[model samples]
Target: MLTLTWRRGDGRCAFLAGMLALLCYISPASAEDGYDLWLRYAPVGSSKVEGYRSALGNVVAPDRTPTQRVVREELRRGLAGLLGSEPRFRASPAGDAALVLGTPASSPWLAPLRHELEGVGEEGYLLRWTRLDGRDALVIAAHRDIGVLYGVFHLLRLVQAGVSLDGLDVSEVPRIKLRLLNHWDNLDGYVERGYAGGSLWDWHTLPGWEDPRYTDYARANASLGINGTVLNNVNANALSFSPAYLRKAAALADVFRPYGVRVYLSARFSAPMELGGLATADPLDPDVRQWWREKAREIYALIPDFGGFLVKANSEGQPGPQDYGRTHADGANVLADALAPHGGVVMWRAFVYAHDVPEDRAKQAYNEFVGLDGAFRDNVVVQVKNGPIDFQPREPFHPLFGAMPRTPLMLEFQITKEYLGFATHLVYLGPLYEEVLRADTHARGAGSTVARVVDGSLESHALSGIAGVANIGDDRTWSGSHFDQANWYAFGRLAWNPYQSARDIAAEWVAMTFSPAQEVVRPVVDMMMASRETAVDYMTPLGLHHVIARGHHYGPGPWVDGGPRADWTSVYYHRADRDGIGFDRTASGSDAVSQYAADVAREFNDVERVPEPLLLWFHHVRWDRRLRSGRPLWDELVHRYTRGVRNVEAMQVTWRRLEGRVDAPRHRQVAAFLRIQRDEAQWWRDASVAYFQSINGLPLPAGEAPPPHPLAYYLSLQFPYAPGDGR
Candidate 1:
């Protein structure tokens, strides 16, 4: 019954009007282009609208601070779109079902609940359906304005999900200190291993003209509790450190500040020599350290609350301390010292290997960092990939995870489907992330999961963090495909609480993105749940890793060899010949198994004790070796390859049934993508079988057909212009 007695922010009203106009003109068939992402804020079904409309018809919120203004405007936008009517704003509670949102310091009525707010940290929030001033209301209270904003998003999510608002008492706190997105976008607007269209950061036009899309990007990330973003490629580009680009980055930082998202830059280690007029870029040199300190000061002056650097030093030809014969800890410590005064931290990467072949490429990172366990500064976190190897279709947990008890290691997951199927495949990475997070590292005693290590619960470290190599781009859907957005969403949710179920996350995303109807939600979530397994089955079945075609990594390449480094070739990894396939990391081979805890190492070394899923990862067996399935190793391998392609077929069939259920545009795009996936999966199965057959000289398993083409034919087929491929 109450209406706004005061004016809204002039800038906010204009922005909303323009955005609404844009939405009005979007064609129905283009709905799945994904510009709206999970924040579509579409109208709820008639059946559920009555109760929600009554309960949330009016809001009692004050817009004093920037964050507070964002919270109020978001409520207006979301409620108007979802409930099909603009909610009235009141200075005080006027109706029995009005909404109340504020920090304890701002609201005298919420002062008594300050004790309750104390439980949730600075980034957490509390939402309760309670009575205020004798009128029943849904109260969203937090310790900080940003927390209040997060609470607002949560309330809108409930409406979007068609869930009941009755007795809603929810409290959420982020388990990790830093939940960040590492964007591998370069200065030239191209992204490394990025399947999405183009870079989101338009540096040429930034610090002068602000794009409206930037605000939308911030909102989407904020809605999912993502708090930080490193805005350039890890492959160091010194040009990004120039004054002009700093201003550009500062412009982005300003847009993201109110949403609790801090901006960090991927500081190229050789920037001193490249941009600072210095000769030797050594961490041990005082002159080199001073140059970095001055650079840090300049960056902090431009963006006061700028999150610190993400360094991928001395790896893959990127300059680092190793060039100066210094350890990773030394490089990280110097930067950490400079940033310490500004309350910043350095994220030093641990995806290291000698350019020359070591005993095994997988052992290099663990060998390098484990020795300097406690040498790193307290503020320096070692950012490590989820798997020991590069972002393959499937890989075992990185050995460095539990090895560094003295240092905090942040889990870095690739959200982009570089090796998976690149924008065209319907692969959900939720299960992949879940698999890594839930894996038992057995570091301390029983329940020492990789999740515990990342959250700092295992080592009792105060600083904990997780980073996802962002799949976000300038594409209409944000990510290249409609489904890939789920990976970004899943990463944020898991980074907030590693223990959350991936299936549950997919369910929530399905309901909010497609429709709240159970008919739509159930089947879509079911497809997502099985997607990653399907990808692993088809692309790299039975513990296979990194066998994609050379250069672009486009297709099957089990026969690929003669690369500059042996580790870069598929033959080095698969080791397929008269013997069976798989890398042997057990004691007799690379001895990578010894990097893990005693119990884990023992299990990995014993082929019988190892899980069959990873049979090929840790052991190299003969073709005739018998598996627990009572089948020969070669037959089991073939069965897995066939199973993978069959799963893709099943997914295609499942998606086809939803022709009329989902929006025509997104539905059409997804259907097309599913078709592509099925074809590609068949290609992978056939190509892999053919290559292995040439080496093993064995007959195809029973009921298996010979590949349609010879190995030469498949090898000659090339994708010279793949989307994410480097020229």
Candidate 2:
């Protein structure tokens, strides 16, 4: 049995007061170290302090797995900060009012609960306040050690979010079994679509020296129930497989292990030739299979729990089995076999397009993957990006979600703001994520949402996963701006529980990051909720997408054309002319809607039945075509673009009034960025309207603002050094 003790000024109450004092006024003191994140564990007032202390008298965590140790350390740290006293740890949970945490293997008391936890799976956990041996105690139980770690973090989150822990019967299992982050970071420190700064993984200084930031990074992800991270860009480098780089990755794996995060690598498909000196990297060849199996063994030897490969093969000129006239399933299954012995899975990316293929870019992924639906290995997951096209401001969910029900499909959402104005625009992607998640694929009838597909409930696949393209960088706030942090937060929360409402996630984030005070939280949550729609309205309202500047995608470029590939040009997507606009994906054209369920196909195929938000995405209407709004297509387009600009201007006003409510530095930074968003929103509206009006010869509607510059001026404007460009 273990004894428990609590000291005054040793818990969350003192820590909160300290942080409040530090951030009260803008000075050198206000510049935070940022290690706190949202888990400052700050001191509560005397009124609430005793309740927490009395409730949490001691800790008893017997599980000795690396992940369970992390949970124990976090509890100690959180209690120390919040209560201002370090709680005693007991060898067993025999004492009254003790906190018991473990898997069945570690805790005899939890052994009886194994049958109840059987449905929870390996990554699920249960937290309950129950009486044991005539004493009140808190029990955190799981089927596996990692789940116990997650349970601890969940409990801490509830406390930080100011929820009552009494009568807590929390049983949480991740909707998506594999929650991972895909970092588009290069070996040279440049991040693809990364706007914050250089990559967090400093390869030059790794293998021998480990940055404390790495641990904190793992901690943050663990807190959000994210369990894996792909440590390189999808445009992979072959040299990442070299022994030197492998050793560096092993070091990171060591740090991440305790936090329940397994490190994964984005593998270059030609690694057999580039790294192993094979003449031809054929999946069917004996030498190629042996090489991959050996490489997998080597990696597992270095880091026992390393997550497997994420491959972007035959996509955007990357090497793949297709290079040798082989199928995608053949390529993925080879690597999957290699890793299968070590209990690893392969995440094969479906973000494929080729200029040589004379088809709508949106239909390419579904065309390729659906053909080989059940051919993939059981351990292979097809990672499909949220939209068929690259992460645009607004796009219909990818058609592959329902098309390939036999294979496990993983949802790949971009947490990085590649199209929606990067980190500058105050767009909270929670609503955007929700929109896609809730979209009824109608594959398994009416209730078959995309979330169900991702969570493996709709198709009942053995393996399920979701990956977010991370936006984290070397910036002080982790993301470039402070509010952008909410996107990262929201991704983790959604990964944990796919059914959670975006509005609810936004409110929780606002209270944790800014203030728990209702007056301050309500306005901020409202702004965040409206932000994604505002960007869509101004930039690509009514399903218009990919109209940004060529290559950089910084501002509007509706006039862009004649790129190396027609698909790269903005004109290819919008297809505006004197007669009509929008890409024809109906029966008269690509017939991409046929890839979806029968009902969904009919709804999208018909011009009248298609939702107004996605009207232009599927159909091209004439300049004078009457919309549901009782306005012509041209006037409605202009109205939506103008309305988006006004919405951003309104956001600027709302942010300016929040000066004193938030810390001065962060407050000022958000205010300044909101100003940038407003200006850029206007630029988007002006450039798009001017270019479209030139093509259609339509007069501007009354009360709509004309372009600030001529069509030629907007077309000539160039952003050679824009951030997040692949180059």
Largest TM-score belongs to which candidate?
Answer: 1
**How far out, in Å, is residue 608 in model 2?**
0.8
> Candidate 2 — which residues are off by over 4 angstroms?
1-35, 63-65, 91-98, 109-112, 355-357
Tens-digit lDDT track for model 2 on 335-423? 99999999999999999876484568888998889999999999999999998888888888889997788999999999999998988
Model 2 lDDT on a 0 to 1 scale: 0.87
Q: CA lDDT of 171 in candidate 2?
A: 81
lDDT of model 1 at position 552: 87
| Lowest lDDT 10-residue stretch of candidate 2 | 26-35
lDDT at 281, model 2: 97
User: For every candidate structure, what is the RMSD over all alpha carbons to the true structure, in angstroms?
Assistant: 6.3, 6.2
